[model samples]
Target chain A: MKPARAAWLFLAPALLVLGVFFLLPVLGALGLSFTDYDLYALADLHRLRFVALGNYWALLHRPAFWAALGHTFYFVAVGVPLSLAASLGAALLLASPLARCRAFFRTALFAPVVTTAVAMAVVWRYLFNTQYGWANHVLGAIGIHPVDWLGDPHWAMPTIILFAVWKNFGYNMIILLAGLQAIPRELYEAARLDGASAWRQFRHISLPLLGPTLLMVTILTVSGYFQLFAEPYVMTEGGPLESTTSVLYLMYEDGFKWWNLGTAAAEAFLLFLVMFAATLALLRWPRRSGA
Target chain B: MMPRLARALVNGLLLGGALVALFPLAWMLAVSCMPPGTANTLPPPLWPAHPTLDNYRQLFAHAGMWRYLGNSFLISGAITLLSLTCNLLAGYAFAKLRFAGRERLFRSLLGLLVVPAQVAMLPLFLLFKYTGLVDSYAGVVLPGAATVLGIFLVRQYAQGLPDALLEAARIDGASELRIFTTIVLPLLRPVIATLAILTFLAAWNDFMWPLIELTGQDHYTLPLGLAAMAREHTAGTESLMAGSVLTVLPVLLLFLSMQKYYLEGLLLGGVKG
Candidate 1:
């Protein structure tokens, strides 16, 4: 057999697997988004109607869709920066000369990266329990009233946010540490010699050098935060009133729970559009700023 | 003089950060050891007055955690094996094979990484439900078989393979698959190990897809089982910690043992991919 033919055979298996499993499903989702195909439609394709963008239109008008979008945006808007700040702080600390037990600290901080999110959420859920939780017990010691962490709608998302930051800040911290290491030491030395304060040195030297890494981390974290399913699924089950119903959670509910496959497909596409556009915007903004 | 004060303050901050980072995990261990309801007091006890393994016994006895652990092991193991084979072959082939449309195909596959796996997931569930794979191990294992990241990693390593060796093998009348198994697989050992750890870690940590697909509690993996136990015992603190411990231990061990390879994979996936 010719080597070219053999090579084709070798590649064929993987391509076929991806084609049938990945590509077809992705395309199917796109088609499903346009039709009013659902569980009822699943029972018989004859029930399916070609509705064009009617699913998207209905999703826009649906209050649930807006609430899901708000929850997701709230998650991304608040969660991303808070996570980045915690990551940046941890990374900066790890990068600092004065920080002792650097190895121990880095490992401890990054420990959550390997943890199952379902398990992490479970641990956090117990930790936030109003009666049995240590969070309230500690507050009680400080003479503060026991705040219902997961029971209150206003506090539920914040608790989830805090849980997410604790679980994930370490992943970005490691990446940022690498980014910090790549920044030339001579730049910091020059700043220090010029009598720049530590904060000033950070602003001028560190932040500018970290621009690309910052952008990359933000894009990754934003897109990651967009698929906020497991946290809410485990901790809130989409809420104390759907306060934590992320786009992915809503998609899961509409698709799996309600069997509204068509509407769920539309929701998934809308989420994809938002994430794709957001990522592109972030990627382009830096180049534009540089220009 | 100023630097000394700054150093002291920084030391204090470092100490505070370490406690914050490590406290929850430490507290988890402590609380698991405490008797039920003992840790739920006005001032939370730092150490359990009477440490016990009763929670673990309870987990194994009634909570059915052992079955979930078995599921986690079996599913993750199957995924790791298949992912290594498929990803290594495809990754290596993409890196060095003389195939038509190789670059374009690989590029498109890589581009799919952007469309969050969650996006296709809604329809993917319906797709699986039709196939009778839902509520079965195949549902969890099939989609994980071939991954873009796995292919990318192997390709990066495989691009470094010597062309002359493959040519010599071909001259000896060896088929492509034979050469790959004997010559290429040996050379790709480092990447295979790295990819194995990564694939296993991901499979073990997977939550959403399995949660949706594994409708039967009988098939719950560690994460799913943990979630179920948490819901079942919403007020049971000590038992929940034990459940968390069971869920996290395998991953923690794998990570600690193979930190170098995993860290290398992380930086490689980040900077290069």
Candidate 2:
């Protein structure tokens, strides 16, 4: 066979899988979104009705969809910064000259990133258990009363946020640590010669140099945080009156549990648009501000 | 004196952070070993007084954890093998082959990355149901058999291989298939290891899709099984921890052993792409 034909032969298997499974279904979801494809329609194609943009409009009016959106925003808004701060803080410490056994600490911190979310969430559920859990036990010892972490609606999302940060921060920690190592030692030495304090040196030298890495990390973390499903599903079950119900969790329920494929497709698209817009805003902000 | 104090403070903070990071996992192991109902006691014993295998025994014999473990291993192993083969072929072709639409096709693949996998999942379920694949191993494994990231990673690595090597092979009258299997496969060992571990860990830890696709208890992966168990046995803290340990231990060990390649793949996927 010619090289071109050979190449096509090589590509055929992957293309077939990706095309049939990924691309085709993505297009199908778009078509499904325009129709009322619930359980009845799922059972009988004759029951399906064409409704252009109706799914989107119906989701817009639904309280659960809006509430899930608010919760997702709440997650991204709070979880991103907190996760970044934790990651940056840990990376800074590990990068410090005085830090000992850097590899051990790095691995320990990154361990959570490798474990299954459902498994760890299960452990976390017990750790934050109301009466017998370690979290409240420690809090009670410190003269603070035991607060319900996953039980109360007001506290459930926050608890999930905490779990998410713990679960994810280490990943960015590794990336930030790599960025930290790439900074020149000479720069730090020159700053020290100029009598620049550690904090000032970090602000002027480290932060400015690490800007690109930080931006990439932020974008990746933001997108990942938006897909907040397993944590709530495993830990809170969108509990205490749907406080932890994320947009993805709502989609899973609508699409899988309730078989409301049309509305679920709309939910997925809205999430995609939101994430796309957020990523675009992040990319454009730097250029627009001339930073 | 001030430097000494600062050093101590930094060490203290690092130690504290490590403790926080590891305490939950350590506690899981501890509770898993403890006798039943011991975790619910006042003060919640940090270590088992007399560690026993009863909970683990209970997990395997009573909770049907072994079935889920077998399912997880089979599904993840199959995905890793099939995905690696498919991705390697396509990645190598995209890198070195003379083909029309290679660049355009690759760019389009990259574009598809932005459309989250969840977008395809709903319709994919209906498609699977129509094809009689829902609740089958094929349903879980086939969709994951070729990921954009897998192809991208392999292509990135394959692009680094010398063109002259392949050219020499072609001049020697070797077919592309022979060249790929004998020369390219061996050359791509490092990346193959990385991709295999990444895919295995991902498939093992995956929850949502398996939870959706594998509806029956018999077909459930470990995560799905554990989630189901968690719902039914909410108050059985010790038994739940045992289940959690079983679900997490294999992947944790795999990650720990191959962390170098695993971290390399992470940076490769994140930084370059």
Candidate 3:
């Protein structure tokens, strides 16, 4: 058989799956976003009608969309930095010469990443309960007043962010550990020989070399934080006045719960645009600063 | 060359971090073994007063967790086996084969990575509904069988295969399929294991797509069933914790056993790819 034909044969199955399931539906979403495809239309195709930008217009005017967007941004802005710091700190300790039982610590740290998010979220909800939670119990032992971790509107998002960080930081820790391990030990040796302190060596040698990996992890984490759904869905049910209602959660309610396909498709596209632009900006920011 | 005091400080901090990471999981297990209402007290118990298998028994008996567990295994196992095959072929083809428009096609697929899976989900649900695949395992499993990330991961590993090996196979009068099966598959074992574990875990833990696609209670996966159990005000905290434990343990054990390849795949997919 011809090499090209054989190659195509190898590619055909996956390509068909992607084309039919992924590519076709993405195009269908674009079409759906321009129309009024609600429960009525879902019941019968005859009720479908094109509304051309009307869904986007309505979303722009809807306060819930804006609120959900704000909540999502809040999650990304706060969660990304916190998660990155936790991951970096853990990686640094593991990479340190002073640390013992490195393998055990690494596995223990990474164990959370492998657990189901919904399951962990449920566990966390119990752990953070205002009355019976261990979090408040520890605080009480320290002579601090109990704070409503999940019951308060203002605290719900923050608690979920904490859970998100604890659940996710180890994943990035593994990647960042790889990045740290890749840097030449000779570079650190030379720096120490030059009488550079640990902080100075890290700021100079480790930071610069780990830049690309850090940027990639940041982009991935930011996009991931933006799609915050399951945590809030399980922990708070997007409640205490919907403080934890993420954009994806809103999209789920609109598309699945209410059968508002047009609005949900528009919500999804808007989110994709935002995520794309955010990652693009992250990719370009360092280049501009260096230049 | 560091002082002993500073070394102790660093190790102590690491110990603290590990505790923070493992505490909730530990608490989940402990609470799952406790009797009902034991956890709803003024101070939560760190260990079960009397460890019992009653919660697990209740989950299997009353909550129908057995069904969900079977469902999860069936769906995740099918997805892992199917997607591994799809990704292996496509990734190998892209790496070693001489094909038309290979680079362009691969680039476009990478570009599609930026679009969130949620964008396609709305329409995909409609597609599944119209095609009568909704509430079926196929609806949940098929769409996940050919992810771009999986292909990218396999392709990255496959690119390291020596071209001379493939050329020699061809010159020896071996068909492409025969060469792939005999020579390539053996070499690709590491990557195949990595991709299989990743796909299985993702499918097992997946919630959103299953929630949307599988509307019936009978078709529910573990995460979906656990979510429903948590939402209902009637379910006991002990049973819920047991459900969470049951849902998480298999993948956790899988990861612990195969962490070397899993971590290798992470760096390969995240840092390099």
Task: List the DockQ of the predictions in order.
Answer: 0.61, 0.82, 0.87
- Output the better candidate (1/3) by lDDT: 3
**Reference contacts recovered by each candidate, as fractions?**
0.58, 0.83, 0.87
- Candidates, ranked, lDDT: 3, 2, 1
Model 1 alpha-carbon drift over 4 Å, by segment: A1-3, A141-143, B164-174, B233-235
Residue by residue across B82-200, what tens digits does model 2's lDDT show?
99989999999999998877899999998998888889999989998999999999999999989889999999999999999999999999999999999999999999999999999
Candidate 2 ranges with C-alpha deviation above 4 Å: none
Q: How big is the RMSD of model 1?
A: 2.1
lDDT of 3 by residue, A43-147 (tens): 999999999999999999999999999999999999999999999999999999899999999999999999999999999988888888899999999999988
Judging by DockQ, tell me the better candidate of 2 and 3: 3
Worst 10 residues of 1 chain B by lDDT: B264-273
Candidate 3 lDDT tens digits, B16-35: 99999998889899999999
Is candidate 1 or 3 superior in TM-score? 3
**Which one wins on lDDT?**
3
Q: What is the TM-score of each candidate against the true structure?
A: 0.94, 0.98, 0.99
| Top candidate when judged by DockQ against the true structure | 3
